[model samples]
Target: MDVRKRKTILFLGMALFAMFFGAGNLLLPAYLGYQTKIDWTSTFTGFSLTAILAPVLAIFAVAVSGNYFTDLGARANLKFAYLLAFVNVLCIGPLIALPRSGASVFEVAIQPILPDAQPVWVCVLFFGAVMTASFSLNWITGILGKIFGPILLMFLAILIIPGLFIGATVDLPPTIIEDRFYVGFHEGYQTMDVLAGLIFAVLLISGANRKGYTHINDKIEVVVKAAIFSAVCMLLVYGGLFYLGAHVSADPTEITRSSLLVHIATQYSGVNGIYLISILMILACLTTAIALTAGAANFFERLTNGKLGYIEGVITVTLISTLLAIVGVDGIIEYAAALLNFIYPVTLVLILSVLLFGKTIQNQKPYFITLIVTMLISFIRVLVNWFPNEEVFSAILNVLPLARFNLEWVLPAILTFVITCFALGRNLNLKRNQPF
Candidate 1:
């Protein structure tokens, strides 16, 4: 690659990193470390699979498909594609993720520093700025990657480096959980980056195209390379946080995720550390909000086939997100959990199916069948939570392989795809050889 393209890749990678490394991204791994204790590394290993690896693969899935989320989803069917896009936009956009980021900013970055400040105004300014940035969709990557990303990284390094040293000196406690890997793997779902990946990859590809990497080969090459860089950056930061949280000397059982992070910060650097964390978190929240808003706006604009203008879409998303932010973060999180559990497994199936089998399996039958099986299984899994006492729901999943691991959909999705493909191919052969 030429120097200009390399620069573009670096910025794109940084932008992607910033976009992914939001409030939950900051909180989850450290809390996992705090909880998992000596098994932190094993837990992080599992966490990395879904949190880091799956997201990068999702990006590649979109890149190879030669477009964004819609193209990949279209493999199943247009209606399914639109429905998936709409739900994903709501989950990751105005309804859940966007508001959650705004709320986090107020909780972590604002309230601690300015206890008297109203969340409403804070969110207004935040999403107002997000709206402004979304106006220049072409420049989202540059603004975040070139500016906020570097500052976020610098502050994060300042916070994690010494904390890691302090944590290293403290002996780790015995793990609280037996199934550390499974816990980490399951906990990784809370990050929600894999879902975000389907959306953000559009921004990256659009950004790449605007930067003159227009050819499909060049676009994929740039995106894939940038994804690798972003993945490495995420791994390093997450690993550092996990190791630091694992060796924390204080009792972490009662503390919340944000509290544990702040406690660790003060443990290493006192009051100055609080300010550092505040800055780190604000930038993290802002970067993520910007990306989410832009992606949602772009998605809706496209989803409507330009009936909803990009500016109008941004305004709508920002208005909804800001209003929800005022209602507080906790409720948003609770709402998101139910919605995520319902959609996450199915979305993962779609991403992996596209990435692994999309090129070879050109037919829609396998995609449709696999997705239906995954969705039905995921729906039952969600129902099991909603009606835990209902034996019908529990009994259905209890016999499925990997149900104990909370992955009841995997075997069924795979078998459905293979069977559908085999059946379709057999029928095609029979028709071809028929006398008529």
Candidate 2:
């Protein structure tokens, strides 16, 4: 790549990093660090697997497939493609992630600085900025990469460098959870980066094209390179935050995730640290909010074949997300966890199937069977969360291999896919042998 092309790729990577490094990305790792404490290595490993690695792989999967929805939707049919795309967009957009970004700003930034400030006003102003920034999708990479991305990184560096060193000063307690790896893996889901990665891949690819990467190979190479860079940045931030959370002298159970992060900052750098962290949270959340808003609007505009224009889509998303954000971060998180439990497995299976099988399993049977089975199992898992008290539901779920780990759907999905593939192959063979 030429110097100009390399520079564009670098910034694009930074832009992608900013988009994925949002509220949950900031808060969850730190809390995991605090909870895991002395067992930080194992826990962080598991956390990075889903949180960092999965998202990176997702970006590559989208790049390799050429079309985001079409490639993944090949086996499932158009309706399934549209449906899954819609749900994924909604989950990462207005319904959950978007609002969580706003709520996080309130809890971490506004609440700390202006104790009596109304969150409604904060959300209004915050989203107003998001709307304005997102209005021109063409400029998103430049805006996020050239400006906010650096500010976000600088703030993180200030916090992480000192926080890590200072955190070591305060001796911390034992690991709160016995199964550190499991806890880390499960907690990683809360970041939702993998889901965001799928949506954001479109945006990233668009950025590459606008930067004059017209060839398919060129686009894939740029996206993959940028994704690798983004992953490295995330790993550093997450590891630093996890370390800070683990070594903090305060009791993890006693403090909220947001509070614990702020507390860690204050401990390391005094009141100045609070301000840095506050700005960090606002900018971090704002960057993600902008990316998601743009992604949702773009997807809807295409979904409607421009019947709903981009501006109209933005207005609709902003309104819904702003309204939902009023429920606050905790509320959004509570509901998101349940929804993700149901949808995430299907998404993972889809990504994996596409990556592993390529064009071989493009026939609808395998995709339909795999997705339907996964959804069925996942839906039951959601119900278990909804009705934790029902003994019968608990007993039935307990019989599954990884039910306790909330991964009860994995085996069923794999088995269904393999069987469907085998059956399809046999049918193809029979058809070939017949005189037709």
Candidate 3:
């Protein structure tokens, strides 16, 4: 890649980073910080691992394997790819995330300042305008490059500047959780960064390709650097929010699945702060929502034998996504998560399989076997959860054997990866493919 190209990659890369750093990214860290009160450091550990590592690994998985929706599901059927793509869009795009982004931005920035008797649709009307503006933009990359490219660092600074100034003014308190590190780690998982990371990998790959690197290796190198830029920003923001979370304690109830940051930032920054944060939040969310639409479109285009081009595919997806969003954020999230949990174990297994044997699926049966084994573990999790009352079948539960949390899936995924590695060692003739 030339200097101009490298600079282009980095610019788009950073913009992509800003896109996904929306409501969850902003509020969760601050809420986690607030929950820890004085134990922000400990809680942040949880936040970083889940929010940071998961997303990074996910992007790396895509780069390492060179797989997106269809490629990721190549081992499976095309139907699975379509399903996976649809569910992923719901999770990140307009359905669950976009409206929530608009809502959270308004709650933090707009709602507090209006006269008590004033209508609330001012914020809703504002976000509706945002949707229109985002739709009118040309290729998403163009929109992001223009909006996020220049503004990302400045917006990040906005959130952090206030937090730092406020932190110095107040005295730090003692720890909240008994084990801050573990608490932080567990809390980190709640952000679902790992899941988002997997989804973002497609965007990273596509964005890298748009810069026109002919070689897969060069393209991957670009992907890695861009992802690093994204991951680093996420880490800093999460850490700040975690520290912010530790500082204030106005309403624990405010920090539900949504609206965590709005509650906290509102407590400290006053009405002016809210307005600034809302604008920043809208920009970040818009970038992410547009990118997600593009990704889903790219995935579908590939999966359907090029039946639809990117533009047409995006329209189809956006229409469906907007309809789903109308059902509301809570429902959409539940629907996406339920489907994702089923697909992800298989998806994770396939990613490792591609890494292990992109060159010789013929030689490595165990890599193929690993998918089944890991999926069985994930399946058990689903099955256990399927039944609300295990006590109804005590004998059956005792006979089948299960973890209380159904988290045994983690062990099997690890075991499959390790076992497949051993198998690959036995079959040294297995082919190794290059990064594209």
Candidate 4:
């Protein structure tokens, strides 16, 4: 590839990172401060690990693994790889996180910018137009590369700098009690970016592959470095947002909205701060929404083996997501995170299992068994939540260990994966004529 081509690839990779970092990204940390209260520091740190570090690492991991993220799942078997890839596409699609981008961006940033004379529908129309434009973006990757690309980086700089500066002006609200660490650790679960990371990092890898440096090591280096760059920026911005929120929320009593940071900025830094943050957030969300639509369309096309193609798939998916965003759901972020608590622990273990036994389990059977078992547990939980009245003991997950806290699936999933892997391994060895 030409030098410029490589640069473009890296640029697209960066854009992928930016797109994953959206309006939802801006709001989660600030709300963390408001809810965690004086214990905001620990909460922020715990959240950052999943919210920032996990996604960043996953981006590089896929780059090194290969073009298909499903390949990781396939390392153990084709079944797992297929399921993971499919789930990731859906998670990043309208089934969950993607629609939330437009809904959130519109609710948190765009609508706020309108004047008293302008009706709320005007904001809705504008947001709808964004969805249209994003669909059309299938034909103009460069336009996005040039415009929203720089806008994202510049705004991130602006958003992060003010946040870091807020640190000097205010100390974190002190931890309110013992076990702040545990609270902080669980708070990280709310971000669910790790769940998003397992999916979206594939987008980052695609951008890198477009530049044509297919060598795994080279891709690994670029992915790792870029993830690091992006992670550091994310960490600073999120931490600042949380600490700054602590500063602004010193009143001990303030209404907590989804857009708490904007509210806090307006309260502390006045009108300019509010406008600045809002614009940045809107732009960030716009870029992110575009990427999610584009990515889903692309993934759908791929899964169907080019059934929809670029233009058709983009239009159809984007339209659906836009419409979904318009209708909106209540407590969307919380719902999305809760959705993650079910799948993510299993996904996390699957991702880790590959890293652990990548070479040892070249056959798909072990991966397939582990992934299927995990999904079985997760899906069972999903069904239980769906029809609580159907299950006799559904109300008593607490008696069953991790189930009480809604995390029962994790330990069992892990246990099943290990047992199955060993059983599979032992069977494979026996079939190899080695009688132990």
- Per-residue error for 70 in candidate 4, Å, reads 2.2
* 1 or 3, greater by lDDT: 1
**Clashing pairs in model 2, backbone N/Cα/C closer than 3 A:** none
In order, candidate lDDTs are: 0.86, 0.85, 0.59, 0.62
Across 1-436, the per-residue lDDT of candidate 4 in tens digits comes to 5576557555655665566677557776776666666677777776776677666656655555566566555555554466666766666666666567666656666556753423235335544655576565333344455677677777666655655565556645555555544555555555456656655566666555565646777666655665676676677667777766666644446454545666766765578766776677667767766666666676677777898786677667666666666554345654565466566766666676666665455545555666667676666676676666876546544455657445566676667767776776656422211111
Taking all chains together, the TM-score of candidate 4 against the true structure is 0.82
Error of 4 at 386 (Å): 4.5
TM-score for all models, in order of appearance: 0.95, 0.95, 0.78, 0.82
Expressed as tens digits, the lDDT of each residue in 1-436 for candidate 3 is 5787678667766765766676667656776676667767766765576567656666766676555644454443444445655665555555556555555544554545543522235434544444454443235666666666458667667767677767656776675556666566644543445556666676666666766764788777877777777778777777776766666556555455345555555666775665666666666656666666566566556656788876676676555544444444345444545444555556556655565555555343455556567666655555545664665433333443333333345566667656766766756454433213
In candidate 4, list every pair of residues with a backbone clash: 76-364, 77-364, 398-404, 402-408, 403-408
* Ranking of candidates on TM-score, top first: 2, 1, 4, 3
